[model samples]
Target: MLLINGKVLIHNGEGLNFVKADIRINSSTIKELGEKLTPLPDEECIDLNGDYVLPGMVNSHYHSYTNILKGTSFGEPLEMWSLDTVALGRILGEREMALSVSLGICDMLRSGVTACLDHIPHLATSHIAAKTYKNTGFKSAIAPMLHNVSDREILYEINEIYPVNGKHNKFPSVKDYVDYYIDFINRFHDPKGNVKVILGINSPQRANDELMKAASELACRFNLSIHCHLLETRWQRLSADNDISPLFKLDKFGLLKEQTSLAHCIWMNEDELDLIAERKAAVVSNPTSNAFLGSGIFPLKQYIKRNIKIALGSDGVNCGTSNNMMDILRFLLLLQRTQEMDYTQWISIEKGLQMITKNGFDVLGFDKPFGEIKPNHSADLAIIDKNSFLDILDDSFLNQMVFNASISAKHVLIDGRFVMKDGKISVIDEEGLRREISAIKPYLGKNMRKALNIANEEKKIYKSVYESLLISPSNIQ
Candidate 1:
């Protein structure tokens, strides 16, 4: 495949520059780059017609399980929202799981995101989602959320506030979950397929020491990245039992390392930030979700100043409400501007571009070179119609992209294959997925309604307990 006559952004580690060039691809890897390449016989040629080509953006953190549950909750903080969405959203069968994951990836492809780290809470149907990605030719790192706490236990903790009686579902033992993750890794880790597994600890508050140590050992043996949530809410930080910070505990267990990527570090203090930077760990911020769930703003300037590798994520469709990285970038840029008073403290458009691209590659530890367009790199790229939003002869493309929230990809290529062309997905069954989702709508609705009723009954008790804990409504609203 040969792509010609495109304005390409070349980032060669030092800086970014624009060049009019042609790219040659052999199978899945980029083969050559120059002004005008003589095409070989039978080579598929595509004329970009002066369109703009950029490396596909990477979503460092995401959740496909809630892809089917958008707009289900409103005006609730992360804690309360999870009670309604995530707790209830897990009630999905294999077929529903497959369709939902496919739809999520389709949305991502349309928005020019070619890679992601999908943090799945339910282990039962994660393989089904993985299968959908494999068939659709998308890249992902699937990390099943590992936590020892059972739903019944959580309900009990909430019940202390209001009185409700119910039996909790039986959960697998700690060893059982660990063995399942190892089995999942052995079965699904494939570099050629562009899909792999990572170790996941939902949070230190939910996972026990045994599970954390076991996950650390397994990740070391396999040399995989460990994904975790760190201080997303002030309530979460206050709820810690001991005086020790969660980062300290994680570090003590050898889980805090260069390969680990922490998500939503919204409530980290100065000391925690310093420790993370010292450990050379990476952080991913979900600006839209943090704002939607009323979680506090992440200290973007602090991370940048400390030299902590930062990446951006959309979080989940249910919370962030969109898979579009363009929108996420806009929100991130604006939020950073509003949070810091110093004009120089805000993130620049050039730096923001790297956060979604090259910085993400470093956080995810992808074996192949990606997040940049160059010779011998994976041919994962997005083509945007320059005329769609920009005026003729206007070279301020970065400013237009960062300030506008409606920009989308005209075509997307994953590993040299056209996953989306002419603004439509070509590699997956888009219509079939739509039909399946429509067919299952009533059943999912019925199940979720029942779950919501149960949540409401329990919320009465949970709310009073929340008040007793003195959790500010703004924190979890």
Candidate 2:
């Protein structure tokens, strides 16, 4: 495959330089990238018509099936009144899971993201989503989440709480889940290749100490990145009962490390900041989701000063906003400025762009193949319609990109194969996905309606359950 005749933004602020270059690939690796080379007469040529060709965007953290939750919740915190994840959990079979992942990836791809760290809760079906990348050729770092809070029985007693919507089915043990993930890593992680697995947990608030320790141990043993959600909600913060704060508790349990990557460190105070920077862990900042959930603003300036590697994520833009990683960047940009009331405190375009593109690949622990477009790197890239926006050019590329170039990222490639081209997907039937998604929505709606009704009934039944159980309603308050 050859990506020819497009404006190339090699890396953030490498200062736009023009090139009449050719990007050549064989099998999966980028065979060559430099000035125009005469092709073997048989090589196919793609005319960019002056578009911007760059390394595809990388999503550091995202939920595969969470796209269904977009637009439904106006302003709910992470803990309450949010549409049920369990609802989506009930109706998604392997097919629905694959389509959801495909939809999410395609959304990213079209918006210029070529890679992601997907947080999937169901292992078997999560594998199906990862497999879509193999078929579609997008890069992915998958972490099947393990969330079972057995040790918080005291909290369960004190607060008389259950999982939101109470949708846990057949809990898998920590070791068993770790064993399953290890098998996934063994099968998927390609240190010398592209698609891989990261050791993962859903959140500290939702996981037991055993799982947390096991997750870190497995990630260390395999030398893969550890991914998790941290401080996502106020109630989650309030749930901590011991002297050990959740951040330091993981540290005490030997979980924090250079290889750990946490999503939504929104509520971390100064101490947690020091711990994260000290350990050299990475964070994926989902500004859009943070805004949507009304989770407090993450301390971006604090993290930046400490030299923490931060990446950007859409967080199933459905749950957050839209899947355009650029929007995540834009919102982060405006929000940072607005919250600080100082423009300089805002993460600049150059730095903010790196979060979505380069830093994410760095966080994934794949230094060579994913982010920058260089010789021997995997051919994962996106081509944008440079002329699509007003005043678009190399001169205005950066400005246009961060501010306007977001949705203009119309075409994408992974491993040198055309996954999307000319503002349309290359491999999968975009319409077919829509058809499957449409066909699936009603079944999901029916099942969710049923489950929600049952859950509502359970909530009614349990109204006095907490009262009788010696847990005060004000505890939840």
Candidate 3:
């Protein structure tokens, strides 16, 4: 296939530049790129008609289960918000799970995101989510969550405030979790294919010694990448026992390696940051979700100074503001700038673009190279219609894209095939999917009300304990 007459964005060592060029795709990779390239006799030709082409963006961290639960939360801290999400997640059957995954895919594709890391929290319907991505031909790394510790156990001084009763909810054994992962990997894991399985430990504090050891073994056995949540809240940072950092604990289990990508390191200290940089691990930051939940700002400047790979993600849409990667990137750049007094030290638009594209590919650890428009690179591209209102200069195109424009893809390609063409998704029956969701609206609404009630009741049980922690002195200090 030959794509002609487009302004293609390419990274030219120092920064990004748009050049008028034609791309020749052979199978799943770009075979050639140059100005006015002649098409082969039998090659399929596509005229982009002066559109702007970009390397497909990636969402390094996301939870697809909450795609259907947007606007369900007014506002709450991360610990409190988990109650509502956990309640709602329990009521979703296979049908709801499939629809939810499809909904997230549609939103992402329209906004030019070609891949994502779906860090799934529920294990029962995780396969359904995997199959949905596979059938739709979407690029994804599905990480089914693993942890046995109850929520109450991970909070500092919570046990002192409310004595531990033997009434905590039962979880699957370590053997059960390991067996499930092995089966899931054998059935769906494909490192070289569009879909892959990753080892997802919920958090260091949330997993016991046995489970952590099992997770490390599974990751090494399958050669899978590790994805886990880290210190996202002040209370979580204080939860560490004996002044030991969670990063060290993970390292002890052999889980903190080059392939590990930790999400939301907002509460990390200098030593932890240095350790991450030394180990060459990546950090996936969800800026919007952090602000929505009142979590502190991520130390972006510190991470950049350490030369750690940083990628952007729109965490659960129920907590985040949007699914668009551009919006996420823009919000991150603006928020990070507020922390820096020197204008020259602020992150540039080019770095922000790299965070959404190149850094994400590094975090996913895919076999083939992605997020580039070079020869032999994956032919994952987003063709966007140039905005007449913002296309005043070649140099200012990226600036307008990051700050002022509401970017959407006119055509989207994954592995040299059109998943979305002419602003319509081609891989799935989007209209049919919407109708199915509408048909179940009444059922969803009823269950949602019940779930909210359950969440409220659960929240009441821990409200006083949470308040006590808020007023308590810092355990870390």
Candidate 4:
């Protein structure tokens, strides 16, 4: 395949710059690049027609279960939000799970995202979701969530958040989950293919030491990348016993490694920050979700100065409101400047692009030739229409693209195959998928109603206990 006459964005050692060139792809890798490359006999040709071609964005942290639940909550903290949504995920049937994964895949492709880390909550439905990704031509790391703690355990002090009256829910045993995850990995993980089944530990607060150690063992056993959420809230930071942070606890469990990727380290202190950087572990920052939940600024500048490997993610549509990596890039750039008065301290457009592309490849531990347009690199590219209204504002195409974020890919290629073209997904019937998605509402609603009932009953009991803790005369003294 040959891509001709496109403004190709390349990382020229220092920063991302563009050059009018053509790309020749052999099999799934780029074979050659230059101006007016002659196509070999029987090679297919795609004319970009002066459009901008870029490396497809990577979403290093995402939750597919929440994709179907977008716009359902507003003004809720991460604690309250998790009680409603993660619990609701327990009732989703196989069909509903498949639809949710498909919705997320289509959204990512439309936003020029070629690959993602799907931090899934349910393991039973992962195969269904994995099959959907294969059929849709999307690359993914399907991570089954691991945790031993229950909601009651996490919110023991504020159990009012839990509903008092509801049907009892029994979670799968740790052994049962581990067996399922091993089977899922053996059945789907392909070293030579684009899909992989990774491991996920929910968090230090939610997962016990035994479960965390076992998760680490599984990751090392399978050589798969492991991801877990860490320290996204100030309350979590304050609640750590004896002033030992969650990161320290995770490290103590032997889970911190080069392949480990921690999400949303917003409240991490200097020691935790230094620990992650020293271990060469990756950190995925979800700027929009952090801001939406008021989790606090992520200290992006600090991470950069420490040389910690950093990547960007949309979190999930439910929290971030969109799967567009460019939108996250814009938010990441602007949010830092708002806090730092020094112009040199703010995140540059180049660094933001690197996070979404190059550092993202590092997050998954993929050694494949990717995140660049040079020779031998994977032919994962997004062709953007450069004639948008925002193009006139700046000569730097990257600056305009990140700042405006109003452009979509005119065509997208994953592994040298066109999965989307002319703003339409070519691998599936998108409209038919949209119609099928409507069936999921009743399932989601059923679980949500049950959750709300439980919350209402527990609220009064929890409030009484909580008020005593706050206003008791002995407590005051």
**1-477: candidate 1 lDDT, tens digit per residue:** 999998788864546755689999998888888899989999999999988888988999999877887777765677777778755766888887787788789888888999888898889888997787778878888889888754334332452433332335345677888789888888888855688888888876567677778878888888888888888876666554224577877898888889889999988878889999999999999989998888889888889889999998888777855988878888888887787888877777888889888888777676787898988788999988977555544456667776954768999999999999999899877888888888888988999888887778656655666566564434433
True-vs-predicted CA distance for residue 270, candidate 1, Å: 2.0
- What's the TM for model 3? 0.97
State in Å the error of residue 396, model 2: 1.7
Per-residue lDDT over 1-477 for candidate 2, one digit per residue giving the tens place of the 0 to 100 score:
665676666643454443446777776677777667556667777767777777788888888776654554445444433324554466678877787777787678778888888888778677787778777767778888877863223233424565542454357877788878878887777755567787777766567677777877786788877788887654455555333467877787677888888998876767888999899999888887887777778778888889999998877655647777787888888778877876666666767777887788887776465677777877887777766557535366677767765465667777777777667787788899888878878777787677566545444533344345334443422
Predicted model with the maximum TM-score: 3
Q: For residues 80-109, could you state the per-residue lDDT of candidate 3 as single tens digits?
A: 888999899999898999989999999999
**Alpha carbon lDDT of each predicted model:** 0.80, 0.71, 0.88, 0.79
User: Any runs in candidate 3 off by more than 4 Å, and if so which?
Assistant: 161-165, 241-243, 475-477
Which RMSD does model 4 reach against the true structure?
3.5
How much is the lDDT of residue 436 in candidate 1?
82
The candidate with the higher TM-score, 1 or 4, is 1
Segments of candidate 4 deviating more than 4 angstroms: 159-169, 242-244, 389-394, 439-450, 453-477
Clashing pairs in 4: 163-454, 163-455, 164-458
Order the candidates by TM-score, highest first.
3, 1, 4, 2
| lDDT, candidate 4, 294-396, per-residue tens | 7788888789889998998888677745898888888888888898999977777777889999888778655565777889878989888878535554456
Tell me each candidate's TM-score.
0.93, 0.87, 0.97, 0.91
